[model samples]
Target: MTSTATSVIPSTSEWTPGDVEQAKEAREKLDIWPLDEYNCKLLNEVHPRNYVTNADEKEGSLVYDLIAIGAGAGGLVSSKQSARRGAKSAMITERLAGGDCLNVGCVPSKALIRSARAVSQVRRAAEFGVIVSGEVKVDFEAVMARLRRLRATIAPADGHPGTEEAGTHVYQGRGRLTGPNTVEVNGKTLKFKKCVLAMGGRPNIPSSIEGLMDAPFTTNENLFNLQVLPPRMVILGAGVVALEMAQSFALLGSQVTVVNRSSKLFESKQGDDEAAIILQNQLEKDGVTFLSSSTVQKVETINPGDGDKKLPLMKVTISDKVLECECLLVAAGRAANVENCGLEAANVDYELGKGVKVNDYAQSVSNPSVYAVGDCCAGVPRLTHMSGEMAKLVVQNSLANDQWKLSSLVVPAVAYTEPEYATVGIASEEQAKKQGVECDVYKASLEHNDRAILESSNIGFVKILVKKDTDEILGATIVAERAGEMINEVSLAMKNNLGLYAIGRNIHSYPTTGEAVMGCGVQYINKHLPRLD
Candidate 1:
């Protein structure tokens, strides 16, 4: 697992006078920290002088209390928590510190989604009795500019300075495990008592598609880099990223088409078909075309020949049909960054397509001294919050004596679509039945919700599954405008082992989306009430 190529970090010695002035101007314009040559050198240094003590004084060994690989949410949290508890911690990262969530995944996508939602709301302003106005248009450049501005502003918090300020030694290089407790970075060996791997994941590209490798395309990593919106966009895959981007781009005036090999949009195991249909229908209404049970056989980029300024077009083949678009976005899935990281050298068990093998406690099964979290951990949910939760558990297990196991049941997942879908605990009723658990289901439609009625957004429902003859809430799902925010209440209930009765007894704010959760709970409780004489 040795790295064939070493990471190269920009140095201050290479910067010219113009480079510094340009960086200063960009920083002032975006209100972001200047990534000048000095800052770049500082962030990319292999080891800072202040942190690494003389190895000769300590018997020729540079030992740290904890070592965290990857600077994403999990690694950041692990290092911070360890340092806060008086442990000498070190974190190593080869790329940007925040990983996918801040750089390419959550933050940028949400920013674009918010801009798209604004366009939708403006288009529907007539429903709110607003006066007649001119046609609404999306300033694509402005939207992207704002996204860049926001990302730059938030970047410093996850940069080297932020982690160093938290009392953790920050190392900027690719970290490879030279031994079970030794990490080698930039020709320097860092021995640690405990280590946590949070290398995260990258967008998975399908190699089977003909000409796809040579075709110009955008994944989540570079989607926000677009300065001008494509007139037509073809997206591969119908998972969360594809669907979310499809809706957003369609709303922002792109003629978007989504191609999927499966007949269904979301995976059947984790997603409800009914909920998928509801979201699909909404996206279709917004001018997004979906080709289910279809796959992209090949792609060819051709010059439109309209003018010099015309962007190149992508010709995609799906079965007997051919679709052309200005851009192609591959959102099939994600691959864990487990390669060339010395997992084999460390004797950590890992699968090729999957990730590092770990138990419920996130500890490496083959090596007790090592732990893996986030997208790099096989069988764990690859969500930002889930990574943060695993970080806490890793910190507890690494530093404290407490041995806490990671629980997937209490973790909630949300797809941030227009009418968001959220679920927690055991979502599949058949799985519960297979486990010999009898469940009672209670449902409430958003159509009956007062807030939904007022907003004319009564298109989803809240469903709760309770153990039959008991108040135990096995699972809950919410489909509404604010499902992401509403699902937290159910997650909190599950975490505290509270029953549906407790949720029902609790009062929610009037005329709010949260009432739907309370209503489902009340429905369950009332359905089981005993008959009186």
Candidate 2:
């Protein structure tokens, strides 16, 4: 998307010499790794070293209608949504406004994954009766550069300029709750009628692993800064990030190995083991390796000297296996960014790993005036869209008397692997059974799909769970090239409380991947409905 960075620049009369000096200091203090041109440009658009706070520009004490403590997906949306409702909203962030998704998680990773997919497609061109090709190569530097470029290009929408343009006061500094209705940021005591805690989460590194802190390792936060692709790479954890990166790097020509603590993949509480195994199998065919039911015992840096140069390689010991790699990526999990935020002072309750405790209304259990959203909120799905949805709920519940419940929302998640794995609602038969709901699973294999067969891309299936003896949809899991897109229909069906029969009645176009979704519906109709064929 195009940025409005130029259009939102503050005029000369609005800023004094003191503000300019503070902006200069802010730029110098900002510590974005590899502070290259692209990153610097991104910083300028989001946090903006020259940004002058709205509080400083206006005279007298100002009390905001809403103050959001982060500028991530949740915070950005919360502040913007509140402002759109004609509330005097203010947002405070210690780092970039767009938070993890824009800077590190989704945007950059997808760019790299798309590039890797292109490489895989080219290598498999002969399968489509296309030959006569030289060595298919990958320029790792160019790939990373493109990723950074894309992030910078899209940063404005979630940055200082775009937020300010949307009528939300953007403050670039750490924000801490000092009281029930006040937050302190950069020596400014900002009072608010209500607050949104959206600091989000960060990549969790296992502290139990010996020598991990001192070892040569990287997280998603800094993984995109690499200019050179390591010849050998090892990843910790088996979640979406770990598996996705493992496959992407493998396709990019790196010898990639993934170490997982559990025997099964996608072992998270909301994970689907069947779908994960399908994706894992495809990753294996692409040259990625997996060491399951394992844990990293120790991590150390060992330099195997070559002449005058001393190149350090990471030595990792997992169970009985020992592996050495030029790079070690830690995708263990996410920990809430709750430290130093003064939750206690704000009468807010929070856990260490899980985030700010909130009720079904997304309001703090301890302080009703304060609400939390995104990864920072405990017991909520840590997805970008989920966060935005929660932010909207927070905006409505806080400002109006709306009783929007978080539990009522149906969430869908996707793991962006080659044959993408997407899941929603109840997840599995066991989960449905435990919830005391009997379910009948309707599955349609892509092998039988006409479009899948024509493209030779038939590797996975679409499986949906419906209430036993009824068409009431409970959940779904899809593993296909476009599973991410296909799962949306199931999510919509469940959200609207529509039965499987409704999907069966709808006409799907001939020869399409989405036919898999319709096929599941067709199965349910054929089993229950009277013969009309």
For each candidate, the alpha-carbon lDDT, in order, equals 0.80, 0.84
Writing each residue's lDDT as its tens digit, candidate 1 over 1-533 gives 11111122222232222366644633443222234333333233322222332123245335777889998899999988887788878888776678788877898899999999998998888899985589888898788767766776777767665666666767777899999889998788989889999999988999999988888777887677576789999999888899899999999999999998888766545566678789999999989998988899999978643212255688999887898888899998888889999999899999876799998788999999999999999998889998888999999988885789886447889888989988887665665766787888778889889999998899999888888878788887788999999989888888888999999999898989789889987887787789998
Q: Estimate, for each residue in 21-125, the C-alpha lDDT of model 2 and write its tens digit.
A: 543543355434345567666777776654667543445345888999998899999988887778888899988778899988899999999999999989989
What C-alpha lDDT, on a 0 to 100 scale, does residue 24 get in candidate 2? Answer: 50
User: Which candidate number maximizes TM-score?
Assistant: 2
Clashes by residue pair, model 1: none
lDDT of 2: 0.84
Instruction: Name model 2 segments beyond 4 Å from true.
Output: 1-33, 56-61, 303-312, 531-533
Best by lDDT: 2
